[model samples]
Target: MDIQTLRLFTHLAKGLHFGRTSRACNISPSALTRTIQRLEAELGEQLFFRDNRSVSLTQAGEYFRAYAEDVLQRREQLQLQFASNRELKGSVSLYCSVTAAYSVLPDIFQRFRRGYPQVHLKLQTGDAAAALPRLQNRETDIVIAALPEKLPGRIIFLELTETPLVFIAPTDYPGTVCHSTNSEQEIDWLQTPFIMPDTGLSRRRVDQWFAEKKITPHIYAEVAGNEAIIAMVSLGCGIGVVPLLVLDKSPVRKQIKILACSPPLVPFSIAVCTIDKKIRSPQVQAFWNIATSIENAYKKGPTPHMKNGVSKN
Candidate 1:
């Protein structure tokens, strides 16, 4: 019922760990539990499913989550309106794949920082599947991911660009198939070893494409992170399947070449994922506007396409 309790629940839902949420809010674990318990008791419903080691939102918890955000957001807006705006302030947390963190986040952060220096930006990187539940739970305010379709629940999807899936091989390597953006002959899947993202989204797309040709990838290694895939290809581990953006001024840019393709593999979309935007504060709104600018200036992000994190060691 209280705003502080609602905010506590929101963070708890995102972390799904009472201890972590308590740490994040700078409160004790017992206090965190009591706050949620009070709120749940007032609502006459359970908000979380607490197991011995972990927690998850129940069906009723999920419903409470939406209304809780609404309440907290409205309360914040009222406070903002009453205060003499001394410059926009507050925090915006974001979760994204490694590529987006590298290639996509810099300018957005730069512009956001210049406009409202008081606003805090907290960035975290994870795979596509891991980010969604965090957004749903309000752990982070924004998410950047490469996905084929829509998000679940009240999350809002903001499309940035449709990126092509391209193959990359080392420059000194002699395959002679990857130097150009186009190809005339069928790529020999049998001869080449593949380096692929370990996550489900990339695996599914690659699997479906290979399934049609009745060709199984000769994977030399299954690596995590886009930079490592590119680095491994440089050391001649295997050719990698990654978004084209990763190749643009990448760390080992000169060392790799983009492979030729017939029709190209599936094009994954780059988008800014968010909790319902309307509930976002004015400072958050301002940053969202800055992020929506699709110009090449803001196009490159923080991690720039390493599947999970940007690199593997």
Candidate 2:
């Protein structure tokens, strides 16, 4: 089928609403329906089941959509492949959560630039949850996140940095702190100020872990990014708990300290993810390879459980 039909179909599959998909495709609802019909005729199979207010992919549609997407991917790659032949000069865009943005990604991008000086790079940061859909839409070449809740048939995941999530405070201003991912004494840190991240699974994990322990510290602030949290803590606004990776050496040694943790903290795995290999461009693959190789980028220290999630400099 035509690329336009496949493009329209891809958006339809995601929106799953005729009016919504039609609006997105910039075509009338009837025309969208006709395109789907034409695609079905060409393939001898229907692609969707529509029953006003609800839409689901037929088994045939599901299978064809997979192939259709591959076709679309190849069509895009063709141009990139040609460009690579000429010279691998184009932007490789990545979407990252703020944690990765501050922690591992800066170093990764630096090294990437050192090696691939001719290649341009673009990066945007947000909660991983917010960034994965952009990956699905092909808005970014790859993404660094905590991994999505579920992997759709169309994407791929590469384990990157598994860094320990830790409780930290300004180097000089500690009241009392405990170290345990499983559980900690609330009384120890009750009066200390807590900084909550605005969003992310790790934020949820920290929140739940505290709630279960029946400990509610006085929150210094609720901030949008890990960088801001660290900055606040470094300024001694209050003690803020953060992923250890977010604290680089100059900042960590001079500004923040790892408060004594009895149980140590739970760790979270960070990974590089993108559309499946068949769809990912070479530049994406090259960057992904380099990232995995630089495993020591953001470690807080060394430990068996922390290897994948925690980075120690």
Candidate 3:
């Protein structure tokens, strides 16, 4: 089958939505249907089983998908092998949090664009926690997110910046425990309503902190994103924990105060994550090079006067 058809099939396999795949591939639904039909005719098997509500790969489809992926990879390698060094072209699918999209992506994109003008960059922003799973599933080419303490296998991490995880509470909060001047006084953490993330590396870290301190948190609310937790904290809902980087960029920065924990929380190591095999594609490698090349810039922190989504000093 043609490479374009294989590409469409791969997208379809991941999304399991025909309309989405068609739109993403920039093709008419009817045309996509025809292409799949042609492939099925050649292979003598249906690639997908679809009904009104859902779409799924057939057993044959799953097998075909593996073959298609291999063929596509080989095709890319062949193209890269023959193509002139001056030009690089292909799409790079990137996943990152909304925070990362605004904060870190602009600089990465600027460098990437200059290096590979012909490459198509597709960036999708969501929960920072979900980035790794999407990368593992091959749904995205790369992810920009906070790295876990124990690294996962078969992935490469390019460290970007380290930011402390800070505890925050509303400035007007009436909780005397956080405001106490007596360091010897014990705070009743069980009575203090706490806001935290439902999942993600931040949540894991917060849980670890509580465990190490031998305190069971009175979890007032388990929220989704750090931005949401910050908002809740700003509204006097409860105390929350989040990366200092996020707090610096938070719109409600003036609403909250950073609380002093007896022992400081560990800083988060933010990085660009990608699977080892996918980077073999020249387009992915091109972006990877750009991201790594700017490591020093990120380590030095955002420049003064709002340069490239990072805040000024």
From the highest TM-score down, the ranking of the candidates is 3, 1, 2
Estimate, for each residue in 129-165, the C-alpha lDDT of model 1 and write its tens digit: 5676666556677788665444566656666656777
TM-scores for all candidates: the values are 0.72, 0.60, 0.78
Model 3 alpha-carbon drift over 4 Å, by segment: 8-42, 46-62, 176-186, 300-313
Model 3 TM-score, all chains together = 0.78
- Write down the lDDT of every candidate, Cα atoms only: 0.71, 0.68, 0.81
TM-score of 1: 0.72
Using lDDT as the measure, the top candidate is 3
Q: After superposition, how far is residue 131 of candidate 2 from its true place, in Å?
A: 4.2
lDDT of 2 by residue, 82-140 (tens): 86676566668888866677666777787888878878888777655566666665556
Full-model lDDT, candidate 2:
0.68
The all-Cα superposition gives candidate 3 an RMSD in Å to the true structure of 6.3
- Model 1 ranges with Cα > 4 A deviation: 1-5, 13-49, 52-71, 83-86, 126-130, 172-191, 277-279, 298-313
Candidate 3: clashing residue pairs, number: 0
